[model samples]
Target: MRQVIQLRTEQLGATARTTLSARSALAWALIELQRHEEAVAQLRGLLPLVLAAWGEHHEAANGVRLHLGTAHFASGRPARAEELTRVVLAVYPVMDGLRLRAWTLLASALSCLGRHREAADEYTALLNAASPVYGEDDRQLLWVRTDRLHQLAFLAEHDLVEQESRALLAGLADDDPLRAAISGAHAFVLNSAGHHAPAETIVRAALAHHDGADLCLGLARSLNGQGRHEEALRILTDARTRCRQSGDTEHVSLLHTLTARALLGLERLDDAETQARQAVEAARTHHGPTHHRSLEAATTLASVLAARGRHTDAREHLTHCAAAWRRQFGPHHPRTIATDAELAAVPKA
Candidate 1:
C-alpha cells in the first residue's frame, strides 16, 4: 500500500513540469519528501491552470484546491490555505474527500494561528467525516483518524481531554503498531503540554513496543521535554549512528536536530552548533531545501548560531527559513510563527 502510494506520488512528479498531472505529481512527491515549499509552489502554479480549464466549481478544480490548501498550510500560509479550503468545501458539499482534506487543513491553519478552539472544532469534524468513510479497521484510515485525535488532544487546553486522548491512543497499542508509534508522539505532545510523568510512562511503553527510528526519536523528544537532556542526547546520538548505517539520511538529519536540541539544553554550545550545522547540510542534501525536515534543520542551526552569540548569522538563517517557510506554507502557519519567534528571540548587539 505504501509503495503504491509512493509510486502514484512519484508519477505525479515525473509529469509535473509540462502538465497538470505534473503539478499533482510534484505536490504528492514534495509532500512525501516533506518539502512543503516546493509542494506549495507546484500546487500554486497548477491551481490556476486547473481552475481555468475546469471552472472554479468543477470537481477537478475542487480536488486540486484541496491539495493546494494543504500545501499552503504546510508552507505556513494558513490564512490563504484556509480561504481556499473553505471555498472548496463550500462548493463541493458532497465531496467526502474534499471535506476531509479541507477540515484537516482548516484545523492546521487554526492551530498555526493559535486559535485552539477553532482548530479543535475542525479536527472533530474531520474525525467525524473520516470515521464513516474509512471505517475503524483500516490502517491508513486509522492513521489519519489518530492524527486528528492527536491534534484534538493538543488543542484540548486542559488535562481532562488531553488525558482522555492519551488513554485512547494507549489502548490502540495492541491493535495498531503504527498507531502505537503515534501514541508515542501523543506522549511527546503531552510533555509539551506540561504533563511530564504520564508522558514519560507512555513514551517508555511505546519504546518497548516499537524499535523504529521515529519511535526512538519520539522517546528522545519526550525525554528532552522532561528535561532529561543527557538521556535525550544519548538516544539521539545512537539513533543518528543507526540511521547513518541504514542509509536513512532523513532520519539522520532528524536525529541530528534532536541531538542539537539536547546539547543546547545541556549548554554544550559548541557541540550543539556543530550538530546543528551538520543537520542543515544533511537535510538540504538528503531531504531538499523545501522539505519540512530541512527547514527544521535550518531552524536548529539558526538557534545554535544565536546561542553562540552570532546574532547576525542567526538572523540571516532565520530570514531564509522564514522566506522558505512562507513559500511552502503561506506565512501564517504555526511552524512559521514559531520560526518567527525564534528569530525574535535572538539578541541584538
Candidate 2:
C-alpha cells in the first residue's frame, strides 16, 4: 500500500467500514493515477465491506461493483469485468449514470471476448437508452458512438462505418474541430476500402484544422497505407519530436511504432527493430502489455525481428500479440488475425 493509503487505513481502522469510505477513496486515487493493478487489489477488499455495510441491493454496493469492474477492465481482465458488469446491470435500479456506463463496459467486454455481433447489439441497446437521456452530441453518447464505429470498422462493415461517420459529421460545422476529428475518423473506412489517397487527403485536412496528436497519427497511418513511407516517416518523426518536447509520452510511443513500420517499408531493418523495441518498451511503461497499443507495437516489432532473421524474437512477440489481442480486441479482429498469421509463418526451432 502507498503511505497515504496505510495512514488512512490506520485512521479508519482495518476492521471497520465507515461512512468516509477511506478504502474506496484510495481505490479511486489509484485508478486516477493509472495504477490499475493496485486499484484492483484495493477494490477487491473494499467491495466486500461496502456490500456488508450497505447490503447487496444497496447503491453503494452497486457502485463498488461498477468501479471494481472498471478497474478489472483497465487491468486487462475483461472476463472478470464482464461478469461483474453483467451482475450489476441486472440489479442496479438507475438507468442513467452507473447503469449507462455499465452497459457501455459490457459491450466492450463482449467485444474483447470476440463476440462482436453480441457486442454490437449491446451497443445499440446502450445508444437507444442513452440517446433520450443525453442528446446525440453529449460527450458520453459520442464516446459510445465512437466505440460502435470502431467495432464496425473492425468487423469490416466499412460502408456502415462510413455512413455513421458521415452522420456524425453532418451534425457539426465544417470549421468545427469536431468535424475535423470526424473527418479524420473516416480515414479508417477509406483505408479499409482501398482509398488510401483520399484517406491521406482527409487526414491532412484534419491536421490543418487542429494540430492534434490523433490527427497527426491518422495522417501518418494513411500515408503509410499508400506506401508513401518516406512521407510517413517524416510526419511521424516531426510529431515524435513535438510529443517528446511536450512530454506527451503516449503519442511519443505511438509515433515510434509508426516510425518502425515506415522504417521496415524502407528496408531499414536494424533501425526498424531498434525503434520497434523502443516503442514496445514505451507502450508497456505507459499502457501495460495487454493494451492494444502495447500489443500492436510488439506485433510491428516482431515483423522487424523476422525481417532480420531473428525468428525466435519474432515468434515470441507474435505469441504475446496473439494472446493479448484475443483478450483485448477479439480473435476475429484484424489485428489478432494478422498476428496469428505471422506466427504461422515463423519457422519452428
Candidate 3:
C-alpha cells in the first residue's frame, strides 16, 4: 500500500489522489506499527490534499481528520487529539461508524487529561446516541460502558462502578475478554472503598484469566490495604518487570504509587517517600498536574511527609490537593472528602 501510494503520488490528479492516497489506511498501519510520529507527519501532509480534493465537510476529509486525531493520541498528544476529534464531530456528526469513533476518541482524550467526570458523561452520551443504532447489547457498547466504569472508578464512584461492573460481567460470556476488565474494575472500586478482602478475591479471580498491569495493581492495592506489604511489593515488582519489558510506561506511575503505599505500611519511610515523589513527578509529567493519578500521587506523597513528621509540609500538600480534587471531582467525592479529612487531621507545626 505504501509503495502504491508512492507510485501514484506524482501521476494522479487531485480527485484520483484522494482515492489512491488511502490516507486513513496508511495512517492506521503506521499507528499499528507504533510509528506515531511518521503517521502524524504523513497525515498532516495528506489532510490539505484530502480537503482540497473532497472539500472540508466531505466524508473523506472528515475520515482523514479522525485518523489524524487517532495518530495524535497514539503519539501522546491527547489535547491535540481532542481538538481534532471535536472538529470532526462538529462537521461529521451522525455518520455510522465514524461518529462512534470520534466520540470514543474524544472521551478517551478527555479521560487521559483527567477530566473523568466529563469523560464519563461523554461516554454516557455516546452510549445513548449509539444504542439505537448498534443495539444495547452490542459489543462496542459494552466496551464503551467498560471505559465509563473506569472513569467512574477514578472519580471514586464506588457503588456505581461496582453495580455496573456486576451487571456488565453477568452479561458477558465466560470466555469474553471484557470479563477480566470488568472484574479488574470492580476490584479497583472495592479496594478504593476499603473492602480489601473482597477486592483481593475479585482481582485473584480475574488474574486467573488475564495477567495484566491493571489486575496486578488492583491485587497489590488489595494486599496493601490488608497490611500485607511484602506480598503487595512482590506483585508490584513482577508487574513492573512486565511493564519494563513491554515498554508500557502508562502504568509505571501507578505502580510507584502503590509500591509507596506498601513501603509506608512497612515503616520504610525513606523508601516510601522516594517512591511517592517519583510517582508524583512521573504522573504529573505524563498526565498533567491536575490529572486524577497525579493528584492521587500527590496525596500519597503528603501521607509520606506526614508519616515523617513533616506536618507543615504535609498540610500544605493536602491543602492544594484537596482543593484540586474538590474542584475536579466535587466536594462529595471520596477522594476530595478523604483529602480534606487528611488535611484536618494534620497536626500544627
Candidate 4:
C-alpha cells in the first residue's frame, strides 16, 4: 500500500509540475516520509510558482503559503515559516482549512521562537475556532483541542492542564482512534510532569488501543518515569522492532533515542551513548540534521556525553542544540531557554 502511494505520488509529480494540488500532495507525502528538508525544498520551489500562477490573493495561493510555512517550520526555519503563515492569516479571515492550519503553524513557530505567551494565544484562538467548526464532541475537534492542551502544558512546564485535558479526552468514545492517540500523548505529558502513577495507567490503556509507534514510545516514557528502566527498555525494543517491520525508519530512530534514555536510567552509560549516537545518525538520514527528530536525538546524545564526563563533546552537542533551537523556535522560547540552561551548566574542562 505504501509503495503504491509512493508510485502514485511520483506519477502525480511528473504529470503536473505547476498544479498546486500536485505540489501540495507531494509536500504532504515528504512530511509523512520524514523527509523534512526535502519537503521544505519542494514547498519553497512550489510556493513561488503557485504565487505566480494564482496571484497573491487567490485562495489557492494562500493554501500553498500555508503548506510552505509548515514545511519551513518542520525543517527548523521557524522565522521564515512564521512570516509566511502570518501573511496567510492576515489576508484570509475564515477560509476553509486556512484559519485553523495557519493558527496551528503560527503557534508552533512562536513556541519554537521561545515566545510561549504568544504561542499560547495562538493555541487559544485555534481551539476556539476549531471548537465552533467541529464542536467539542467531534473527534477531529477533540484532537485539535488536545494539541492546544499539549502546547499549554509545555509552556506552563506543568501537567495540571494536561491532566484535565486527558480527563476530557478519556470521556470520548473508545472507538475513536484520534481520541485514543490524544490520550496516549496526554499520558506522556503527565509523565513528563512527574505524575507517574496515573500516567502509567493511561498510557497502558492507550497502548492497548493504539498500535502506533508513538503510543508505544509514550508507554516506554511513562514506564521510565516510574523508574522501571528495564521495562522501559523492553517496551522501546519492541517498538523498535515494530517500526522496522513496518518500514517506518523515523519511528525506529525515535525508539533508539528512547532506548538511549532508558539505558541512561539503568546507569549503562556506554550503551546509552552508543544508542544516542545511533539515533542521531538514523534520524539525520531519515529527516535531515535540521529536523526536530534529528535535533532531539542529538540532544540525547549530548546528555549521554555529559553523563560520561565528556565535557568538550557535550559542550559541542549543546552548542548545536542551542543554535538549532534558536533557528527553529527563536532565542527566547521556553525550549530554547531549557537548552541554553543545559549548555551553560556543562562543566568546563
Clashes of 1: 18
Residue 9 displacement (Å), model 2: 17
TM-score of each model, paired residue for residue: 0.57, 0.72, 0.92, 0.69
User: At residue 217, what lDDT does model 2 achieve?
Assistant: 80
Ranking by TM-score: 3, 2, 4, 1
RMSD from true fold, candidate 2: 6.2
- Winning candidate number (TM-score): 3
Across residues 209-305, which tens digit of lDDT does each residue of candidate 2 receive? 6776767887888888778999998888778777877657656667888899899999999899899999988777665565556777889998998
* Residues 1-349, model 3: lDDT tens digits: 5445545555576657656367668887998898989989998988876776656787888888988899888777889999999998888866488889989999999988989889999999999889999998988899999999999988888879978988898856665789888888888788878899999998888788788888899899999999999999999999999899888888989999999999999999999999999999889777778788899899999999999999999999999999999988898888898889999999988
Candidate 2 Cα errors over 4 Å, as ranges: 1-26, 35-38, 109-119, 135-137, 174-181, 241-254, 277-349
Pairs with backbone N, CA or C atoms under 3 Å apart (clashes), candidate 2: none
lDDT of each: 0.70, 0.78, 0.88, 0.74
Please give the TM-score that candidate 1 achieves against the real structure.
Answer: 0.57
Q: Please give, for residues 61-122, the per-residue lDDT of candidate 1 as tens digits.
A: 78788777777665657778879878877887773666766777776666555454566667
RMSD of each: 9.9, 6.2, 3.8, 8.1
- What stretches of model 4 exceed 4 Å from their correct place? 1-54, 70-79, 109-118, 156-159, 245-254, 279-303, 306-349
Off by over 4 Å in 1: 1-53, 71-79, 112-117, 129-141, 152-158, 161-163, 170-178, 189-198, 212-214, 225-228, 239-261, 264-267, 272-349
- Model 2 TM-score (2 dp): 0.72
